[model samples]
Target: MRATIAPQDPADNSDWDVDGSPPDVVIKLSCPNAQPAPPSEEVESFTPAWTQGACDVLSTDLLSAPIQFSVIDVDALFDDPIVSVQYQVTRADIDRGVMEFTGSGALRSVAFQLTTYYAE
Candidate 1:
């Protein structure tokens, strides 16, 4: 699934920079081999840790400004579910763009993962 940035946070926002320059970037998440059905409650609880790790990895790059991640789509195939998550990083959030992890079991398998996209 492909998720485009919302109009409210268009990719061309001039203000999306700390140094008055927009970073060329795009953020994407894919769960290709994920189980079709939701993971058990026990397994679901560990999602936060996984998200935290991803956030840490994303934040390490100084080029990319921190952006918040949001769920944009989810497709459940016969074997695995294709989850598409999106994030929008604004200039305003650059300074305060701390990585945050959030998920919902009801949506199935800790749906909705997000992080900021930065320039390479």
Candidate 2:
């Protein structure tokens, strides 16, 4: 999913970078039914991880709720959120083992892998 991003954080409209340069981005992947997975690292335009992909392995139980994805700028003092979106994965998605979704807020572009295994 993709949406345009400005230099400021959409969450609070704060500076995204401290040094007056572009922000290095990170991806936060989570599901409401489970604890958030580790933050995935990425570089400029958040392309490194997004172009390739970030992965989080989870159980089918976690799929009960919509998937959560957020983009954040990695700051030395603190990280700030740029965008967040929630997508409900349906049985069709599980059966296909892949799903296509969209962005809801402030996202420029994003791709993350939610790996799940289930019986047919």
Candidate 3:
């Protein structure tokens, strides 16, 4: 039920920074039914290895709302998107527990897992 984000290279990925430095990276996951989830801890790296981020949606809500996954460069005044994608949850997705979807913009790889439970 943990998720990870690792940015790739400029030739293959994107240079999300503008100041000739590595971007201050954070992961964002949002859903229409809920307020935006809090941002993950900031890291300064062109290729950052971040894990167990702060973005997740309830299994029950997955079908009703789309989930947005974003990689952002956190700035003092504003944040810029590095890569973002909105995913529609399918019944198969919940059943599989792990999912991989196409990335938006310059990136090309994105995958994550979600844990689901049952209650009676």
Could you say which candidate leads in TM-score? 3
RMSD of each: 16.3, 4.1, 4.2
Give each model's whole-structure lDDT.
0.29, 0.60, 0.63
- Backbone clashes in each candidate structure, one number apiece? 4, 1, 0
Name the regions of candidate 2 deviating beyond 4 angstroms. Answer: 1-15, 18-20, 32-35, 50-59, 99-101
Please list the residue runs of candidate 1 whose C-alpha ends up more than 4 Å from where it truly belongs after superposition.
1-43, 55-82, 99-120
User: What would you estimate as the lDDT of candidate 2?
Assistant: 0.60
Residue 75's lDDT in candidate 1:
16
Estimate the TM-score of every prediction. Answer: 0.26, 0.61, 0.64
> Arrange candidates by TM-score, highest first: which order?
3, 2, 1
| Residue 46, candidate 2: alpha-carbon lDDT | 32
RMSD of 3: 4.2
Predicted structure 1: clash tally: 4
1-120 per-residue lDDT for model 3 (tens digits): 222334433434644555656678777777655657676778786545456553455667777777887877777787766677788878898898877665434445556666544434
Worst 10 residues of 2 by lDDT: 46-55
Candidate 2, clashing residue pairs? Answer: 3-107
lDDT per residue (tens digit) for residues 1-120 in model 1: 112222221323323233333222222332222212222221111122222223323333423433333332111322112233444443444456442334332122332233444438
| Best-fitting candidate, scored by lDDT | 3
